[model samples]
Target: MSQLTGPVPDTVFPRLGWVDDLVVPALREAVGALPAAEARVAGYHRGWTEADGAPVESTPRRGKAVRPALTLLSALAVGGSARDALPGAVAVELVHDFTLLHDDVIDGDALRRHRPAAWSVFGTSAAVLAGDALLVAAMRAVSDVPCRSAAAVAELVGALMELVEGQSADVAFEEAPAVSVPQYLGMAGGKTGSLMGCACALGGVLAGADGERVGGLREFGRRLGVAFQCADDVLGIWGRSRRSGKPVGSDLAARKKSLPVVAALAGEGAAARELRALYASPHPLAEQEVVVARELVERAGGREAAEEEARRQLAEALRALSYARPSADVYRQLQEIAWAMVRRDA
Candidate 1:
């Protein structure tokens, strides 16, 4: 395994090109193992081809591939080669996409990565099967790892279980009358935190880090994951509005109990009261109502609360990194990456 970069550079997306070089090729190979029908849907979802399975002449659609970055960085952090953790990186990325596929279906989201979701392109059943296939591929991909394969499999399976639990709780919260801050954090932990934790832990395992060190890395990633979600919830509402002054997104439109909304509803202000009433209404909010809800959340202090929580979680993530006792260079890279999770604009 070759070291991709000597240190973090001026580019905002550090090592993303390295991720593309390693993970994308491996992912393409994994997806090729699927049957043609399932492969077509998976390929389309990954932005590799058209719906009909033709190669994309233009730019291929892709997400940030952040999970794989964490995996590789964690290996480096624990004194292992980035290339040694490629299996873990590939596994985590596959699992991440699996969740996205199912989430789009569960959320009734037609668009993903700024285009039609797999469920929309192929029927719901086909999309689901493709996601399922991807998951199996993920498990298979990691099971062959030369380093601590059993432990790696255990980490991946544990994260999958947590993800399912979080997703179930998220769906249930849609109809629940009240969602406590603790409850929401727990959900976010299961839904998003677990995989990130696994990503980091798997890297440590591949690096042959001790149990204590692996545990620290996992904690760091878990806390960072929650912070990431907090930032994401806030961005979902206000990222675009930073320039336009209009908070908008599908999360608000669907009234998902995201961190910001839950934080706001927990407030005692008049804006919070109005927000509660609006959420309790049987009728779905109109487009204008979405804007009102965004404002109400801000005025009620939900946005501030979420932002505060994000900072606190970021601190905890950094603290956990300290416990892992990485080299100073690794610490700087990990710290920068964790901060980036909360500081992203999109």
Candidate 2:
């Protein structure tokens, strides 16, 4: 129950060092292998270089390497060398970046990590093409793994399909008159949890773990991923816009029907009624309405409900992790990282 409210701990997971040392380097090499134009766009999007190919230090460009870290950590937890899992780790990270590049365009987000989004900086078409390149690259990386390559590719393909479905649901929900909490949770799991489960499963499979252990690792990641999305919903409304690198109430302004918003609308209360009326308006919400929408969601106990769900999911993740029976050190690190993810301030 340690607070994860401030600066990132030096070690997000025990194998984070491996991600930094191996997975990141491998990603760079993969991007470098792209065609010149595509490589430039991918490199810029990754925060490794500027749009003009100038070397610059933009830490914001390098996202928190959680997925790759999970891949490597799960490998080590299963008594496999991180080196053997490098390709899978690289594939997972590339898939994440591919989704981010396309998602920014889909969400009409102009900024990411306090900088212009890839689409804004490099043009939408270039960003999209770059994303496509990354997706292909991810598949190639996984398919090239020496052991269990076919299974790894299958896992990634399944996750990517779920990602598309989830994103479609998210977009459709914006126009739908009502969205159930169950539907919202399902979308959350699809959008955020699927890849996480795949990442862990790939690691365990690559490590030659038994099916039961692999299933346990995947369950751990899946629950943690859902918790991660719930925490993100809280941040979308209440977190500092500057710190989180987005506008305040960004989701509210767009009528995104995120978890909290959907929950608030589902509640049977005066505040829920008021919230529905506000959402039903044809026009996009103005700044003042955005502020009021946040308050209404809170008043309807949406924030509290979402926070409780996050904690509950995290606990489930921990239980699943325990089922995996990782070494003591690995278990402690994974537990800490899971808590940090759900309890983060931004």
Candidate 3:
């Protein structure tokens, strides 16, 4: 087993060599099954290939791979081998990539993982098409898993439907006058939680764990997913570009109604009015305006409210973990990862 103490490791599966050493290879192979141009775009988006199709000089951090880690770890928690869950892990990762590719296009994000987004380098059509290809590829990745592969695919597709609904709601929110806290949380749960829950549940399903245990794992992942999003919202407004690999206050610049921003708008008095007006402005925010927006979010108690909610969700996640009945070592590792995710600055 890998060390779980000290600072957070470089990868979500720092202890599980197979996640990086084995699953990644299989994922790449699965991605390679796409058409040549689509495969090139996918590889480049995954930090494996240059724009021109040459291999990258060194490995780059594609993403946290938290969903895949949860899938493999949940399998181990239920007394199954990590290898047994590799197909599920790969499927979840592909689904995640598909969402990101389309989200980048929708949000007009120029940067991802400290490089140009696929939509920015390639055309929007290529990015969207590649995303569609990934969804199809993800289904193929899990189609041949023994025993419960068909059921797993059904679960993933259901989660994808939920994700689509959440994204649609998010887009609609841009034009709405107000969004309640519950509504925002519900959207976050759908957009971020559904797939995470499915990832954990797949482990238990594949391991033949009891329904109660699978449900517990699913709930644990759901709560953790909310906590992750809350922390991410915090980072979006105030985190350093160097650490987050995006411009400071990028959400503000885009006029995005993130958790903290929404909470701030709901506050009383002059600050809220100022924030509302700033958001309503037609032009992109200037750098100074972005700084002001960040300050306004902090001063209006939005940051505090969002942080407190994250802590609450984290506590709830730990409560769910108790019912999960994970092994002693696995429990420790899960706790560490949970804290790292909920408490992270970037």
| Top-TM-score structure, candidate number | 2
Locate the minimum summed-lDDT window of 10 residues in model 1.
1-10
- How many residue pairs clash in model 1? 0
- For each candidate in turn, the TM-score is 0.93, 0.94, 0.93
- Badly placed stretches (over 4 Å) of model 3 are 1-13, 61-63, 242-244
**TM-score of the candidate numbered 2?**
0.94
By TM-score rank, best first, the candidates go: 2, 3, 1
Q: Cα miss at 319, model 2 (Å)?
A: 1.3
What pairs collide in candidate 1?
none
Candidate number that wins on lDDT, 1 or 2: 1
Q: After superposition, how far is residue 76 of candidate 1 from its true place, in Å?
A: 0.9
The parts of candidate 1 lying over 4 Å away from their true place are: 1-10, 60-63, 241-247
lDDT of 2 by residue, 167-271 (tens): 898888877889998898888888999889888877887887888888889999888999989888888888764333677678899888878888899999999
lDDT of 3 by residue, 1-346 (tens): 1111123445544565556765788889889999988899999998899999999999654436778888888888888888888888888889988998998999788988788999999999999999999999988877888788877787788888988988888888888888877888888888888888888877777777787888888888888888888778887876543233566678888888888888889999688888988888877789999989888888887888788778888788878877878999887777777887766554
**Candidate 1: tens digits of C-alpha lDDT, residues 185-246:** 99999998999999999989888899998999999999999988887788778775321112
